[model samples]
Target: MREAAPPKQLAFDLPLDPRYGREDFLVGPANEAAYGLIEAWPRWPDTVCLITGPSGSGKSHLASIWATRSHAWTVPASEVTADSVTHLVSNGALVIEDIDRPEGREEAALFHLLNLARENGSPVLITAAAPVEALGLVTADLRSRLRLAPGATILPPDDALMRAVLVKLFVDRQLVVDLSVVEAIALRIDRSLARARAVVAELDRDALRRGRRITRPLAMSVLADLGVPDDETDEDDAPA
Candidate 1:
């Protein structure tokens, strides 16, 4: 007789696409400034405004909200080019995202787009991981133009914001987790929406793999597996 095969480990790895609707965004102190800037719209301090934050800090969500309200299309940094500036400006308003990722010839193209957008009275919203000064753009004119645009920065999440983010992430994944579980994990992890997302994903995967429901013990085990230490100090030490 053939030997029995080992059990296969199960996984739930479906992609989770977050909803970018205005109502879907969670507002907290960390991102209120950025949210307000997006809400201010054409009344913005300048025709161009920049929003900066760490990865997964809701920069794209804020940009999406603005794009919808302004009836503008979004162009990634890599896609901005001299050849596309005319068509980009034709959109009446624009959002250029992830400017930190410089691609071939992107510096000159972005400079051209900015100039054309200004001349045509089209408002532009730009998002990056860092401010204009830190992007290290070789184009002098582009640097000058970017600096002119007023900017908002989204700080990391606080305890309340992190808990809220965890709840939202669970809802986005259609997981009905208990409040205690949310509270338990929120205290242990760093103050990052990205980290919250990772934790939730890991817990979901672990629960599914074990063919068990998500519970406090499972959450703790998953947290340990992910190397997230339990420290309440994160709440007290949140950024101001």
Candidate 2:
């Protein structure tokens, strides 16, 4: 008789739309300043604000909060264009997200948006993974204007923040993990918000595959599969 095929992978994943409610945000020293800036809102020192941080550093989360409060229109940097600048600025508030190294095509458009927002007295929030000077924009006017905007930089997450982020990520995936499991993974993996997201996603997939609840062992196995340091694993797994 032919050998039976192995079991097929299951696809029982739910929509992982992150909770962007003000209450869902876990503020810590790493991002308190940025959070404060977002909360400041209409009282901002200028019409434009720049929030810079590493990927998964909650830039978008804060922006979402601001958008909700200010009724701002949101658009990615790549999608911005000279033609859309007028329409985007008319919204009274706007968020231009992920202004990473640009191709210069949108430089004129962004510069125009900034000018229009300033003229119309509308508030604009711009987020980026790097500083304005590092975005590689070829337009000097845009570069200078972006530099003038009051900016808040979010530092990497601390231990407490890391643990909280892990919990939130698990919650986002609708996975109910114990504090022990969350703490174990938080202490073992790299202290990065991006890494936290990746770990949670991987754990969710692994748990779905095994049809088991998220446990310490399952988290450990998923971390190892994700190439987390073996020494880190050994230290965490050791008896107290």
Candidate 3:
């Protein structure tokens, strides 16, 4: 008789690290254009700024930095309402996130807020995975206004960006990993900001459990466990 192994239990130690300021943002060729725009501040070409990119591409990170520096009141679409937007706008700047759909009353409210912000000379920042035209917003006027908004699309990270991101992630966690360890995993990671965070969290937990500093071999094992391809696979399975 054989017994099946139980699944590994996951830890829920979500430590809050207050290090997501502008200094934490890594600049690279892929995102330098967007960074340039963010750095422009209130002098941007338009009153509204849209940041679009693929998931885990650092759009949200850049948006957060801008929000902090601008002191903009950032809110998710779910929290926005016809009543709340006025106060939010009156106080200062504003940001609306998660505009996946414009079916709710919030969409109309966002439209009102945008128009209001434009008239009042306040800049609005938005983040979305899809382009402005592809959102299929229910409100026609909001769509038109968004069309006029000046924004930037962040591209996928190149090798330099990946290295910087991986190294930064480790530093954020206060890990003592070396550059070689970072290099080995950065090239093998799934190439998404989301994946980078997940792998780093897992590695931190695993290293703590094993009472070891993160090393190249440990990074490889973590990548392997996460189903990321190994360097050996390219040669091991190559055509002979």
Candidate 4:
């Protein structure tokens, strides 16, 4: 007996977007101000700023772009400490990520880092998934400073952002998907950068295994297979 042939796959070999620079960051009403503010750089209203958004929003991306523009070092929330702060702020700026995640005594260190960075004239960009006040920081001064900043939140992606995100995800994966299929998928999915990214990843795998093009019907099938229902139906797909 002859051995069976393996499944045919459409190779989608490409790196994630490397141009996460200011120019590469897409802008729409939802994230326009946040984009502009971060781009403003070295001219922030305050030494420290809070950028809040839902998990899939582009808070981290904006932070990354600012990090590049400001030539800042990046530190995870868990690693923030007085000792680490001095080293991280050597560049006169730093990107402190995941300030929303609760960790023991970590926020207090952030409070000190904020003051120290301000004293050193180094600005800090703080990214959170929730409102700045809602992170449950135990330090009162930290809370006060954050409240004073009263930062901007990256709202969920709008239609234009959603479509652009979908196309970018597909292109990064080196998969050329039809616009109709992208719109079909976008309408059915939650409007978030993360959701757009996740849907593309899932569809990429499904297409490779099934040898199917990323099309409207295939998108419908994949959405079902992922147990993510097409919550809103598109009139274009409906019968006359």
Q: Which candidate wins on lDDT?
A: 1
Q: Per-residue lDDT for 224 in model 2?
A: 83
lDDT tens digits, residue span 1-240, model 2:
999755646956665777788988899999999999998877999999999999988999999999999999998987789778888888899998988856534887888889989999999999999998788888899889989999899998899999988887887767898898988887788878988888888788887787788898887788788888646544456789
Tens digits of per-residue lDDT, candidate 1, 141-188, equal: 889988878989999988888988899888888888888889889888
lDDT tens readout by residue for model 4, 1-240: 999776787656544554576666788999988888887777787888888899868887898888888888887788987677677777888888888888734766787788888899888888888886688877888888888873788988889889998888788778988788988987888777887787888888888877777888888888898787766867785878
TM-score preference between candidates 3 and 4, better one? 4
In terms of lDDT, which candidate is stronger, 1 or 2? 1
lDDT of 1 at 159: 83
Residue range with the least summed lDDT across 10 consecutive positions in model 4: 10-19
Q: Which runs of model 2 end up more than 4 angstroms from their true locations?
A: 1-9, 101-104, 233-236
TM-scores of the candidates in the order shown: 0.90, 0.90, 0.85, 0.89
Residue 195 deviation, candidate 4, in Å? 1.1
lDDT of 3 by residue, 70-169 (tens): 8888887666788887787885677777676454636788888888887888888888878978887878998898888888888888878888887788
Model 3 TM-score relative to the real fold: 0.85
Candidate 4's displacement at residue 221, Å, is 0.6
Superposed Cα deviation of residue 124, candidate 2 (Å): 0.4
Candidate lDDT (C-alpha), each? 0.87, 0.86, 0.79, 0.81
